[model samples]
Target: MMSPIASLTLSISDNATPYYLQLREQILAAIREKRVSPEDKLPSSRSLANMLGVSRSVVTQTYDQLVAEGVLVSKPKRGIFIANTSLITMPLESLPEAKSAEPEKTVGYFDSSADHSVFPHKAWAASMRRAWLNPDPKILMGNYRLGFPQLKEQLAKFLYSLRGLECGAEQIIITAGNRDALQLLQHMLKKHVNQWYTENPTYPPINASLTGQLEHLDVQLGGALPPENTSPWAAVITPCRQYPLGISYSSQCREKWLQTLSEKQGFVIEDDYDNEFIFHGRPVTTLFQAAKHRVSAEERVFYVGSFSKTLFRGLRLSYVVVPKAFVKPVLESQKQLGQSASLPMQPALSDFMASGAFYRHLNKMRRHYRMKRDYLESLLNAHLSQWFEWEKPTAGMHILLRLKTPYADDPEISGFLKSYAMTQGLQLSLLEDHYVDPMLATKGIVLGFSNTSENDMECWVNVISQCLGCYFDG
Candidate 1:
């Protein structure tokens, strides 16, 4: 009998995606096409790795994942075989359209604000090595759920001095990142708080965090709160520079929220996401301060920040500053959930921060990011002025451009442009993505400059300008 299935070859690409993922997809495609039948034995891992001219480890990992996923099975001595297809068959019509087997090569979009060009990898690694070499034995143990004490103390000093926060080491809880921080908040506070307010176009993860635990309410942030509704149990807000829009809350709006939270016995979670990179003289004083000073303020304000955006995304080090009253309960919640960060890394981060290396890194990044932001600003002014209007952001990595031409906000136009830009190797995102209700979103563009290196500006600007012009004509 013919055995094309056994002889099937794997194809790979040199795109942004990893080689292992490419291999996985190709094999799955062969299976889906029925070129490899149920119970059909493919080449052994070693054979396939040689045939494909790839690492045996990559092939092994892919096969293992498929085995665990039940797409393939292994016999004691026999080679790996495809699982019975009928048992887990997907209808041909049900399969979504496949992406290009080989994606085009170009600088793909980046969501991070970190400048890869100037990442302080050497400095950070040295710090980690030093701390890892001689960490306090207690830190290596998993007793503490809140952050390490030394790190928390360093964070307390850094936050209080820099971000206008007033949390003691006892009240600080280190988390994996913003998402983990919110998840911990949900599990900890769900018993007492069931109603949460978030910005209309809030970070998508916030919604996911609050789901099933709290009623997520929308707040139209640039102005005042939605008129005279019952106060929520708490409000999760990004105060320093709101996401997508890149606008700071006006003074009046900040005061209004403070007063509202005070009167209604509600809490405010101030997510100071982009505080350190402000192009302006200083960041806005946090609303947490007002909540701290006033009656019962401690319970009413939560300050959340992370080093991921500032230092590097892999750090996964974030923190929340709570009132003294909350320290025990939050820690108890952490204890029960067994959620904590890397054992050895926390001390390294503490050393980095305490040694002033972290702050110094931020200072350098601020200047670098500022330059990139300026480059973007000039490009937008020169090319996109007719079609968009924007407030140059004083902080944050992205700027939201309000669209001038019609039809762009229409689902078709936005969707088409995204596909078109991708085909042409331009990385861009739709402003509509941030809105809770995509239909209600305005026509805008969110351009991230932090990762847009100097060399990238010319090409990116030309691509965007040409795309916008074509969009206008058609």
Candidate 2:
């Protein structure tokens, strides 16, 4: 009267893994774990192959290897059975000790859960193929450490024209990404710079990067920069579109920062991320432009931007525009540190930029995101009106939602929000925890509307409303 127990075999995809090895491992684990007991009837190789979703040859080879190892026995007429070898699990204490005495270290921080499903794969693939077929072997096989010279030159002209800066090709240093540039720059200036300055609710990665050597100056909106006589060594600021808070520094603020840097004989590392994607009217003039017009060349102001946000994450291309004097040392240090970029990537990106395809793509995405941002603003305004408030972001992929009341701490709120959102097939980001200065963490969440579908957005907005209502009603 009982239903027959169905037999199942392991199956795997051709995701850059070997088939025979996979088959061998699966069969071995089954035998060793006593999942297949001695004298247990096994399916024929063909049947097993079909069940496991692999070729018969793979199964046959694995079984042959196991038989040779005496772990599996095959009969003339009957099917294969497990051998009588002992099954044991190894313990850590029984393992061989490491030869070198190395200290164990574990570092932890907020991990951004980037939504990769939204990547433009078709466009990226086309770009990759174009680069692969490029006739220039220098781009394909040359020392691309200093980066593609053409890309740097184009970037120099672009920055000069667009940002109203006096940057030249020699001053532009290509990097893997924003994080790489920041970390490398920090390393480069760690000894020379003794203090750091940023907005209180600044980007966590930059805040975290400045921990050891430099003292952090946390400034709120309309906050004044430290006096130059104070001798604060350097400042890393997001002048255009501040992270999380989404506030842009005013012209007065930019003047104060420049004046402070000039008097202190310090430097400013201006991050222009997401400036091009501004949803509002024309973006305000950047610190780079401000300083370029006001300060001398020896003042040491650096401008950094990343294409990772604009093009796609995998591009891993960002550039830093330094003063001409710092170029030789920066390039020399890059060479000594073996810090180079992907050869084909720079040329491919260069081709995309020169052909105007990059700008076209940017224009398309900007319009798409602007629409999404408007709709998202409408949804939030309509449903969770009483529970939270957020400043309309001028640019960037994320929108910061400031909770009106502390309905729950980060863990509780995040769990409740994530639970409800996941049930409704919606995703929301908890951005408050991105702060390293714990006191500066907002009672808020970050909504990434760029990656979600319009339908998903509507449904998620409703789900968020319901969730917030439930939390409040109780």
**Per-residue lDDT of model 2, residues 1-474, tens digit only:** 111112324654433346777666666565544456666666667555433424467778877877787667888887676665543232334322223345434321121222345545566567657766744766534455567888888787766655566667877888866776776676677666766666566666776655565455555685436535455466777877776667777667777777765554677788887766766677667676676555562346888988866766545678888766677667667765545344556766776777667677777777877887888888888888788888877777778787776564444666687677766655556655556554546667777777666676677778888997886686
Cα misplacement distance, residue 141 of candidate 2 (Å): 4.3
Where is model 2 more than 4 Å wrong at Cα? 1-135, 140-142, 209-214, 223-232, 405-428
lDDT of each: 0.73, 0.65
How do the residues 207-261 of candidate 1 rate in per-residue lDDT, one tens digit apiece?
7767564444444446425224464476788766777567677887777777776
- What TM-score fits each model? 0.76, 0.69
Candidate 2 lDDT (Cα, 0 to 1): 0.65
How far out, in Å, is residue 398 in model 1?
1.3
Error of 1 at 229 (Å): 4.7
